[model samples]
Target: MRDDAPHTSNVPYLPRRSVHLDFHTSPLITPIAQQFDPQEFADRFARLGVDSVTLFAKCHHGQLYYDTDRAERHPGLGGVDLLRSQIDALRPLGIRTPIYISVLFDEHAATTHPEWVCVDEEGGPVRVDSHGVPGWHVLDMTSGYRSYLAEQVTDVLGHFPDADGFFYDICFDQLSSSATARAAAIEAGFDPDSPAGRLDAAAAVSHDYMGRLRDMVAGDGHDGVPRSVFFNSRPRLRLADELGFSTHDEIEALPTGGWGYAYAPSVARSVIPIQPRAIGMTGRFFGSWGDSASIHPAAALQYESLQMVSLGLGICIGDSLPPAGRSHEAVTARLADTFARVQAVQECATGAQRVAEVAVMRAPITGGEGVIHADAPGAGELAALRLLTSRGIDFDFIGPGDDLAGYRAVIVLSGVGIDDGVVRSLTLHVESGGALVLSGLPDDVASLQPLTGLSSADVDGFAREFVRPNAAATGLPDFDFVLPGAVRRVRAEGDVHTLATVTEPYFDRTPDRFSGHEYTPAGAATAYPAIVARERVATAAFGLFEAYGATGVPEIGDLAAATLEAVFPRPALRIDGAAHLEGTLGRRSGSSIVHLLSYLPSRRSSADIETVVDPVPALDVAVRVRLDDRSPRAVRTLEGVELPFSVEDGYVHFTVSFDDGHCLVVVEEE
Candidate 1:
């Protein structure tokens, strides 16, 4: 994280480090793991703008990807030094590679020397039937297994200092049956026949055992890279550090109806004022909501998600590797490509000149739309914010009014619970000539009542997701209107410009922890409308709008693409449809690389579908850039080279294309 650039007020914009791949992922595509092809991989990422990767899976395991004396070949598996070749190839691509070590999952060593494994609840060793393996013993970690683990971790790290750091996975099961059973074993005096007492020893062994190993990792002489633990629930921050860990990651991979990658930037960022270390969000079990869809790698949501993390929101994107230790080559390629873009962003951000002269925007509610919806208890706002950010729209920040004059627009989220003062400030933003938009008011009024022109009153229902392509909109027929009276006519553009409208209102419960109110059954919806506009460049970005993310395509109060750009007028980037893929920004040679990734064989799985048995068959990408801001530029495609630009509304547009499952394109000023 070192840089030669002098710090500035904008230094907060500096990029932070990120490693998307985690060790515990379940790869449906059979992750591409072969005779490590470093050069080819490096070249792939070089195009993407990434240069660092945290080798989480087989990188640090005692078992080798291929046969090697340095480690044991996992039982019934061939070996491959995927890490070594990847790292070696990456060096030339100017990428940093790191490995994750699960000192806990050394099946070979742990099972062979059960003494080194963790004990059960009572103080005796934990015993698992190994799923179907009837006699395989669960290694006991509590009973003096420190040396064994340290050696394993150190050895793995020692092999690759060039790696960014270590991503520790599933080592501490603070809330697993294993811990419960171990506790019982301890009370039973390690008595196997003690009925319920069968786990006390195992629990104590696990708890104390992990603690000791943690100390050794910190105190041990041979220091590997800084370590980060996965979804560690051991509450105290100091405790995590004492155990040789620097990062306590957010939860990753839990079923949220299948939203791929289990982290929400909006929720995470909203909590930053309270806890800074809650920087990362990790979700392993992803469940798709009937409404939400996969991310488009070329879209702003991707950028916003990363930016939210960059702006003090650490991110943890996790996936499970195949049991066979293989990763889908296509998936890996997409990862590498996006990693490059993210790396570039981070590099540019961290090493930039900071100048503290800009304005910020608050999420806006135009016309009849008012305060935004309250956050659901478990669903954080970080993801929502990221969705906005990924669109490249700069949002209004929360701070002193001194910065207000610096901003051109002030959006108001008119929800049932908005404090009165905000309503007053919003009244002023509109009166001052700023553009606005709204969602989920009433259809009774033919025109927008307040907020900004970002909305319209004709009240067509919400529009279909652009990714799916819908020319018509289907929104809430009508709803109760909650006008605070503080808002009035912000502007009258005539037919020349119509009031814009966001999609339908969404309902959700606030995170059980952050709110003071009792949970209510009615639930809260994004009652507010969205607004958008361009602000001063250095001081702030143009385009600000409130959005109730896709609870379902074209919701009653959700934001729409056409309306979004209408109110904002200016945007960092624009897209045509909803995406079948996800993307991110990266760097390979310390430059910006924008990644657009989609799993190959993209057979549509409605967010409701669970397991990913196959990937999308075709996930190509095509972005039109403003290269030189004038002349037309050509991007290559399977169809053939095509012009990606045309003079439209006084701006030059160029296309950068990626196609069929996975693709990427980098844009550097010519």
Candidate 2:
């Protein structure tokens, strides 16, 4: 199948203002439908500008909210067909309703059928505990639970014929240590204890279960039209090829949650290649999901939602209904303010493609097969991203499977082992006049010697070393001491030139040869070249990006940025603004849109929440867009404020005052 093939028939109907309503109720809760007025709820959503909503059919407690024959309804519910009422109320308003089903963390199913629970390595059921509440055990997909899930999904689809789609929650491959799991593993001809065997077994079971769920939904949709299906797993590198347009939940509880502020932007950028049409899912709570009393500020919610749109992603705001089934009026009001801004940009953002000149290629996790072993960003890659973002450089994260010909330059981070596929693609890119800025040389540098213009020699590394720029290094200052993680000595051949040199310390910092504090001072500059550049390829022997990210050394980041500028002198777009001002470019048909976002959040205390104060004062900014041969007919903001612009040397230059937290500049071509 083609990479851009349509995954579902309902792709055109996917909405920007989608809400994921959480209904995970407990058995002790009563009067579940006391305040559940279907008309009022639907009207509230419509007032909030919501075009799509995901209502819960079944929650994690295995409690069915609706009256079902295949599954038991919640004991706390008062015999109300809540799901049918919701679908009926929302269908007439042109609001698409997608049914949500918790597949793995079904408490009732696990308690009734212990054989279906996944067994961990310690021979115990896989259980989760969340925020002082005892969590439910996970169900093994390879067991009879798979069939039960299929039946539950089929029952829902049969009942709600007008449902827009299905959102499968908590669906993952768990490592099973049960007798049945081991038997299946042995039958697959592998040792049950091995990691590869466990991965293969889990992948196979998950794939089969997902396929079954898809088939059931496809067979029972409205009027022979198959609804769209999405699974909830972010950073799904291993299963991207199998999954379609899904929701990526980057549960970033800003300052204090597990995901930091940078997590969403990084993960969202990386995920675009796998699922281009993916939607970003964040919560309205101050902390995380299921936090009933915690509500985020409207400003915070607006920033998060706009961040998603700026990165070419749709937005889904997550909210949880109380046991009384009453929607919070305060929350709805805040959501209204946030969604209004989303509606303003939805027309330009939808179906638009990101315009990036630099593609920062992530190192292959498992050689070239693209099987994910680790999903976290590497030290060097994270550092490069931070540097680029701080300097107002537009870039995107790409994988081995992504096409590199569209980018003007590609930066390969440290420790990326290039396989045959990557070598072929990079070679073709360079031959087409695209520049390459590689941090470290690949293992098989011999194959790429012609492009790199250097031959590998004896590699010399220090526990801590400094980098000093040579006379040829313009726009870079000579550093007295800067940390470059590792260094490999290379002999320049043909027309290669050394840009910088590595300086070694007096002695290696061992317990016996330790200096006064950290390490000995830098002694003499070595003959080994720190950075080398050929005709098109520039290679840095040291792990400059990774070390700078890990250490946050100002010198390291400055040197790295300088070297990047030297490699790609004239980027497609350049922005001159504050460090916190973020800009991204996107193209929709004959026009280009530049999204400028100013991040000005105040840290009141050491708490995890970021409070948004008044908007910062407008900053003087200049944007230069290289149009090649095309000429711009007009340059203006989305609000129709014309900006003064001039064309010089095949580039369109303009200046704007950025004040309103967010602004979009449209460049229409003639």
Model 1 sits at a Cα RMSD from the real structure of 13.7
TM-score of every candidate relative to the true structure: 0.42, 0.91
Q: What tens digits encode model 2's per-residue C-alpha lDDT throughout 403-492?
A: 997788888887666878888898999989998888877766687677787778877677778778764464566665557455777777
TM accuracy, model 2: 0.91
Model 1 ranges off by over 4 Å: 1-34, 56-71, 75-82, 103-148, 157-164, 175-244, 247-262, 270-670
lDDT of 1 by residue, 103-162 (tens): 455556654565655554456644444323543234445334456666665565556533
Could you tell me the lDDT of residue 58 within candidate 1?
45
Error of 2 at 600 (Å): 4.9
Predicted structure with the largest TM-score when compared to the true one:
2
Q: Local error of candidate 2 at 269, Å?
A: 2.4
TM-score of candidate 1 versus the correct structure, residues matched by position? 0.42
Report the poorest 10 consecutive residues by lDDT, candidate 1: 536-545
